[model samples]
Target: MKHIKFSISLLLLLVFASCEKELDLQPQQSIGIDAATATPENINGILLAAYDIGRNTSPDNLAPLYNGNYSGYLNISSELLGNTDQVSWNGTFDYLRDIFNKALINNNTGALNIYSDSYAIMGHVNTVLANLDKFDDAAERDRVEGEAKFLRGIVYFDMVRFFGQQYNPAGNNSQLGVPIILTPPDVSIRIERNTVEEVYTQVISDLTDAFAKLPDDNGARADKYAAQAILARVYLQQGNYTGARDAADNILQNSGHSLTATFAEAFDTDDNPSETIYSWVITQQEGTNISNTHYATEALGGRGGDIAITQAYLDKFDSDADQRRNFTYPGEGVSTGLLLTSKHVRQFANATPVRIAEMHLIRAECNFRLNSSVGLAPLDEINALRARSSAPALGALTLDLILNERELELAFEGFTLHDYKRTQRNIGTLSWDDNKLVFPIPQSARDRNPLLEQNPGYN
Candidate 1:
């Protein structure tokens, strides 16, 4: 994997040069601020660049590392960590080992990559937002602005959740979060962290505006429902059950999206299933490295068996009836007897960002929390997802039951860690308030900007 050089000064120039080449225009040796913001085509290219960063992966920059491996989406076997019971990677990468162990350091490469890549993408989005007047057509300008805000909202949400403590609505969320860079900063600027409350305020503000301005029909791009879905998630994280329930209800009532008839059909890589609200488009010509990370072995056409499923996690499935369990294959990689997830078996499998099933779960949880049978009973919502998989429906619902369903239904799509942290649930031996659960700001970043403070518990 190749890492792209990223910095505020360089990003401006690269955005212009890349857009010029993408539009088949002569490569400009120099780009002025005015020229970069003057054309619709130029702004569109910048937006595309923002989307492009979501797939970035490398030892130093692993934006794609979020949901799958680190969140226990797949079980990993590595000799570097000293576990020899299962098949493991023979290579010695301290960063990978540290992340898997839930013992991250300030200098970890994977954490640095996520921080850098997220902010880099945010920089592009900020550039677009700052130049909304550049577009002559009002509708085009609104659409672009909406999409930029949606991206910004999600990136900030991702960063805050990782760098700060979990949101505590009752406590006012005063814990420090990542710096909020709404507009691109000057080359000399240094930033301090915002409170978690402040970050969520901005996320909700951006997404609220995005939901209003975004068109309903932007295929594969940020659409209205995507913003709504994310807004619901943000509310849920904050423990605003009513807000989450309302936002999710809005999507269910208005958004045409629905679940696929079968669990297997929902994951088809060839097309965006009806369940998908938004997905990172992966085409044959250009695909993701997820297959290599999670499924790669001689049997799976990957370089090595980088990740496998733990028997403990697999046991969560009902062996007698759950159809989703079929997606797992007995591992043939380094973990020869373990189970490997086949969800992203192909290199070109599209990455689902938000799906309709999540909306159902959010609504279910929110309703359960409020103890009001507002839209749908929590039991019905849980049953809806279970019925699709042929799992036995529960006669009653509890917070524990809903969370268990979430663990099984939403596993590997990146919500596990956040769910645990926000709900104050423990994962294995790690508690919700554990310092290890929140990643330290990379040492490289702190060294560059004197004002940047390290997260507590890291030197």
Candidate 2:
């Protein structure tokens, strides 16, 4: 499951979305930059290309290679790695099976792509930042910088969480995080894993800057609230309840985003629903949707059903009346008896990175924990989401109940493993902080960079 290194391959990351050209980077810079990176259009092209981070050219549909960082892997990988009894990875892809079994080695292709892609995105955004002065308009310049920072902050936050030990707010958190690479590195530069605290601080810095510079309306790219949304999640992960609550409040109150009319209306189409805060749109010509490729059955245009829902996941629902529970279909062929998710059934649906519903959940949990209602009462927030599915509401609530509600609402949208670790809950028999849950630094990376140290337990 080894892969060719992505360090060079990701250098040519700027192309028109309509063209959908394959990314092929060599040792030299492929895109020309004349007279301080030439025109503003060139800068914009580079920025747009940052979202399409497909690396794998593999022909296998079962292991579709459209590896955009914002794709289904972000959520699916988290679901598999921290799986308790909720879902089963019955797929033939060995790399994914390893993640499900918690038996991953450094050479695992899935793990390597995730690790390498995070770094490659950082590198891509760095290029964008370096050429920001190319734009003559001051307002456009600030917006471009904000978007680049947003891209870097989002991937860096994901990298630190997946690659470093879970952050403990009360502790100093001196643990090794992935390197904080602000500038693109050449062959001569050595790298080191910054501390968990350093990475988290950098993420906050980048997002905070993005929040200030980004506009209220910028089409589909990261806007002001988008930065705030990621900041809220970052604050929650770091146990800053007050900060988390405040950020979520900003999104819920002023983002002008709202919930879908029904649970079934939330997905499948491009993330154009009012609920989506940030998304990466995938036209059929742009790239294939990895979620659909893996989550759907052959009849629906996916490979043999790979990811399936389990009875345990169904039991979490309050009743059959809950509409989200109805999003089920019998599995394909050999796995016909199993159940698969209906959330991902289209090949070109947008990969939603953040949703308005996520902010609501964060606000509810933070409010309950602090015993202070910042936006809506905790119970009201929880019930608001439940009402979408016509699920029965409860008269009282506990932290566990709120957390459970969060799980049910965010199913297949990512945030499972992060939530489990943050709440100090175990994945079945495994401890919440099990080393197996953290991805090993890809061996290929270490072979190239001597200064980059590995996470413990993969050796």
Candidate 3:
């Protein structure tokens, strides 16, 4: 039943993603920001389509062979870039290898895909926001609008992290970030990059509005708690420990979500465990888990094996105690000793973007940092997940214990690069804020929009 809502059918929507402001004509796919051209049905389609676009799960995307921006590399690009040889990128895609090696050029296809695809999702949300008035009922309109903002905020949050400099809490983060485009592309579309601080301010604003306007349960779609969950993440990212703890406390105290019966049970999106605060759905009929294709081997219903596990990762935890390691296995027929992860290997496995498990960690870390226990004691919160996995409980808690717990729990779930940057952990020789750690602005974007500027290292 977990698949009932989003499994309806795949949508073929032309989501426009462009940087050109001075255009001879309005783009053909432009959803003119006018309700006269949009109906209730059309608005609904656009909103639903935005979800698919984020995951790039549906067919008929700009490119069909590989995963589109978010779905394919949502986890890969980030993890690979911060991998530090801990995980192997055996995939044939050179663009990904470029990202991992930090040898990215301005036109690196990997960076371009993520940059453009994120904005494409923004285009969908902008279109939806423009047509909320199409619904006659005021409350319904608010719900639809909240959902749009939820998705738009999500895209912006991701875009700024991948393309712009990391958010700074102590000083003014005036560094250039991605453009904050709120309107759908029409006759005029020139926009400049917003500061990292500005982009985050907008993200928080949008998500705060989403939290206020979104309903408690919108099927498998984003609900009120989903917005709050992302807000908790946003605060955690910005090092607002108080806000992160309070926000996480709100969900933990009232959201009725908890860890699954076991650690592994939380991963099966098909079960739709309450632990999953938000997830990107994948169905054979609706679309595929291309993210899985890159991570799993051919035997586990993925491509020949783009990503494999290294023995180094195994050494991170007590292999005998940590149940999470049990999922790793050697490649079916390869003598090269390549190992695959079952997390994304299973056909049509859903991508988990946020979950209650993360919330427990956030609350724990924030409480530890703030010296206040809002929901549970720091050790209690930490042990909740550890105890679930049967991992040995710590006699006490420290910052390193909390961080290692996060690493153990969120490993290979797309937290690598951002976690490193946030915690100021160096990726080997590269400092946490190294220029190479940042992705360059795609040259194609600069070609179309002269106003945009590149990041530090690309110079």
Top-lDDT candidate index: 2
Give the alpha carbon lDDT tens digit for every residue of 1-459 in model 3.
145434212222433433331221234454444532257877777777667666665444344422455565767878888887678877678888888887888878877777766766676678778767789988888899899999888878888888877789896899988888888655457678899999999999999999999988777688889999989989999999999999999998888887888877777465467788877776666556666777776766676667787877877785467787676667765414787776776667666557788899999999999899787999988877888888877779989879888877888888889988999999878988888878888887787777788887686
What candidate 2 gets wrong by more than 4 Å, as runs, is: 1-26, 29-36, 54-66
Ranking of candidates on lDDT, top first: 2, 3, 1
Order by TM-score, highest first: 3, 2, 1
Judged by whole-model lDDT over C-alpha atoms, candidate 3 comes out at: 0.76
Q: Which one is best on TM-score?
A: 3
Error of 2 at 1 (Å): 38
Pairs that clash in candidate 3: none
- What would you estimate as the lDDT of candidate 1? 0.69
At residue 234, give the lDDT of candidate 3: 92
Instruction: List the candidates' TM-scores in order.
Output: 0.86, 0.91, 0.92
> Model 2 over residues 91-210: C-alpha lDDT tens digits?
899999998899999888887878766655565577689888787899999999999999888888988888888999898999999888776434455668899999999999999999
Which residue pairs show collisions in model 1?
75-308, 87-334, 87-335
Better of 1 and 3 by TM-score: 3
lDDT (Cα, tens digit) per residue for candidate 1, span 360-446: 999999999899766788899889899998999888888988987887786656666777777886655667778877778888777
